[model samples]
Target: MRGTGLAGPGHRRGATPHRRTISILTLVGVCLLALSATQTASGEPAADTVDTGFAIPFAGAPGYERLAPTQVTGPDQLNQPLGQQAADEIAGQVGLNRADALSEEQYRDLVAGGGVGGSREAAEVIDACARILTNTNGRPLYSHVDGHPTPSVLASYGLYVNTSGLLESPANADAPTRQVNSLIAPGGFVGTWLRNNGATHTLIALYRSAYTVQAVYGFAAQQISGAAQLVTNTREGVSSEVGMSMAPPLWIVNFALLYILNPSLAAAMPAHWAPIPSAVADAIRSSATGQVPFSDYAPYFQ
Candidate 1:
């Protein structure tokens, strides 16, 4: 019978060839499952799905002329949050030691003197912090002595500014409109106004006594005092963590704060980047607009 026609290794050894094929396929599937689990633990996005088609809002630039009455946030989302975080850290350090370092009278004098004995870098950081914390639109009130005078652009997530300025200062239902305006007249109050409008729970800043500022939320005053202290201490190198990590490294923190307070600027910031669109760029140049219109950049937000 031709030696039973069973060629030794050449013929398939299983009783059912189809069953053997299925068994091999099962083994391959098991190997793939183990590999997928490893990828997940390492923080990798899954192979079957990818992060796409979703963008953090980028307004390209503010548009002053097209301003509408709606609440409009300027581009600094990342810088605003990072600024708050840095400010909070600075505040905690200052609060712990402010009383021992100087009397209330001395502290007042130092702040009035543009933050004396502090690193000029520290002074600028404080200014940057105050700007973001106090910003209404993407524009903070003070301009940087060096670098871009307007608020930093923000493209990533964090805090953002509304250009309209009006949104952040909507009159408190229970408080007189005049009472609210009283807090806004000085070169400050952007942050305080935002708080009054229920946009945030708290806001803080370190400002010169020259500015007449008030917080609609009474408790925010204490927070401001603490923030001022932090700015003072960081400049003086009083806090080791701030001195070692944040002060000398003010460039990083300051840039980061700018990124948070004005996300659009942050996006537009950095060397060799394209300028924002003409309209957006022009609006940013015109601080008077306070913020850009939502309709112009609605696509980015969507």
Candidate 2:
């Protein structure tokens, strides 16, 4: 008999075997991509299937309209759990202690003290422990010095935000929204307003005394403090790990709270790469439109 490895009589004349393999693989990729897109996040697609289409998650710039401190957050931005309010209320009672630092009993007592959100299910308790962080000194993380957010503070997030440009930049020929947004009074809310409809959460977190600020910060500090990075949320008395979340490299992350609360600090803020005002505005618009904005600004910080 002929060698078994020899080509079979049914082999096609012109098409190479590898060509058939390539065609099948290409078809498979297309079908998988379509399936991945159709499935909800709960479907939990395979890593290879999911990674092929997803963007890396990170904070993008706030919108031009949101910078105004007046516009309300649409529904898309307010997806927190029903219990988040209770969680914050409990947090307010605990003051600045990291949720885990407290025993389950202490946590419950704190919740009871607030007259809100009782003991969470054992499984849900972990998330309940989660709260907005604080500065290294463990004080209120979002306090503002009064008048407005600082220009340099906004610039770090790529806004070039100033009282004059709260809604848009001044006469900067380089900024995209200069013409239209410039003349309008800034009507958009910053802070949680950028991500939700929690009006005055920013002020409630900032102007409130230490305990109240801690409560609000426990609820929504990331959207409020550090302009977005570093120091972690820990008071001098707590364990270093208790509240410190998201310790982005201090080298790249400027201390935004320094200027956000005290606009005067912007005067001393050393320039890193200038944030692109147009890009920031585009990010804001994208968020408003329910699209993901390009968040990879590592190069700008560099």
Candidate 3:
């Protein structure tokens, strides 16, 4: 809701609707290019074409590809070793027990109850969650390296982190940052938040899908009760339009907030949400101009 009026840099508060639309379109192009560049630079392989053994109802739909597992190194940290401390922490925060690993039979039963239009939809949800939790090596992926945290790996499976910028120390530490901090304080949404406050409806839909996936896992593991009820609730919230219809605009607004706005305005954001420091921005520009490789920004990733 906060960014409903946002266009892009140079956009005035009362800018014409046409201009705003153009700005959003341009930003969408930029985001696509950035994602392409990232994939090329990382040399990640194309998404796996292997059938999931479950039909994804929206598989070929626009934005559905975002739900597929990304080809990243060490992406299977959630399931290996069975009871990782971090996974346990995530489960506890989401009302689950770490000691209760889901059994194969239980997983099937839970998926059967998903009520997602048909068995195929249910199976798709299970497969997606399995991909997030386990990797190609049949081992769990680690979410952090040393002291540095990585972007939520679940994002590749269509579950964006609801705690965006919460860990960040914004320059001004504004009200919005404070609000987000409070929302994620209890960590119930570590897997996914069922309720929406400040985030967009589309985002909430995405979170719901993630929540359902986790709920199925929890049910299978015997960590939580009322699996049938949870599946019914989650099924009602699934949407096919969220990724393409809502996410791109939201991303554009966030990008403007973090990179295109003037320093003063950017600093007004929460520390984690703040724009890249001028020094870093300059370095990026230099790298873009061939003065250095983009790897110069590797420190920021750490």
- What C-alpha lDDT values do all the predictions have? 0.25, 0.23, 0.26
Q: Compute each candidate's TM-score over C-alphas.
A: 0.20, 0.18, 0.21
lDDT of 1 by residue, 52-142 (tens): 1111111000111011011113543322332334433332322211121233443233224323232343333333333433333344343
Tens digits of per-residue lDDT for model 2, 1-302: 00000000122468676874564345435534553454332212224211111011111111111111111134221111213233333223222112213334433343343213232332122121111111111111121124433212222222222223232211122222121122111232122221232223333432222221121121122222222211222233431210012211111112122112222221222222122334443443344321221224223322
Model 1 regions more than 4 Å off: 1-80, 83-85, 89-181, 184-278, 283-292, 300-302
| lDDT at 170, model 3 | 12
lDDT of 3: 0.26
TM-score of 2: 0.18
**Candidate 3 minimal-lDDT segment of 10 residues:** 224-233
Q: Give the C-alpha lDDT of model 1.
A: 0.25
Report the lDDT of model 2 for residue 16. Answer: 75
Leading candidate by lDDT: 3
